[model samples]
Target: MKFFLWVALVVFFSGCNNSEKENTEINGDIVYDMYKPSEMSILMNEMYDYNLKIKQEILEGKTPVNFPTNFLNIYTAELSEFKSRNETFQAYSSLFVENQKEICNTDAHSDISERYNNAINLCISCHKTECTGPIPKIKKLLIN
Candidate 1:
């Protein structure tokens, strides 16, 4: 009986530890799963800030010396992986990526500003569908 009790306690404690590693326990009965942002989400927000600067330069009639091309390279791969999981996200990402590439390739101020406006529109379209909280800030990217 003593040996059996020791084995049971060891097994129970090990199982408890493993469960704790996977989830947070609340009220001894409820578990609230934790959510970590995907790599693409973090990269997207960073690029949004950079693109906002590009918008500002356009507004001031100043050409940007640097365009954030690396953002496209890094996020595209992650977006591909994420796309396999969520079709809606994939569709919006495709629109955003294509215009962003055009923005980088544009050299003439007239063309660059037009392409940047198009890219900002894509951002607005996507956010309107899934994440509406950023709509006001995104509107700031518009030329008008």
Candidate 2:
């Protein structure tokens, strides 16, 4: 009788453990389910941080000379699942790259501050049409 009771208890506990595992699998693990940013989102964030640093450099009377080559990836980076590339996005991205090059080119005729602000403005303009969520944050990148 004692042996049978012990085996039943063990079987009951083992069944409960199996049910718990099923529940976890069905509900998803919070740690692994966290939001993963798309490639474009990640690149845009890096660009924002890089631009913020450039802004500080300009404020301190220093010219930003380094152009992150990764900025070019904007043309190829993967956007969020719901977003798609369009003509307007391509146009704004091209203008952005042009303005960015001007900012980094020491020999360029344009004023550094104007070029920097234009690049930032391009970001705002593009976001206005596509993803307006970042407009307020991108606005902060403006020099003035």
In terms of TM-score, which candidate is strongest? 2
lDDT of 2 at 84: 75
TM-score per candidate, chains pooled? 0.59, 0.74
User: Local distance difference test, per candidate?
Assistant: 0.64, 0.75
The alpha-carbon lDDT assigned to residue 53 of candidate 1 equals: 79
* lDDT, residue 5, candidate 1: 58
lDDT, candidate 2, 1-144, per-residue tens:
864554444434332111122122345632222235668878888999999998999989899888899999999998655457889989999999988878988997877889899889998888777767567778999977
Q: Which model scores highest in lDDT?
A: 2
After superposition, the stretches of candidate 2 with alpha carbons farther than 4 Å from their true spots are: 1-33
Tens-place lDDT per residue, model 1, 1-144, is: 864554444434332122234345577843434334456556766877888777877778766665566665543545312235367767877778787767766454557678888988998887776656557777887877
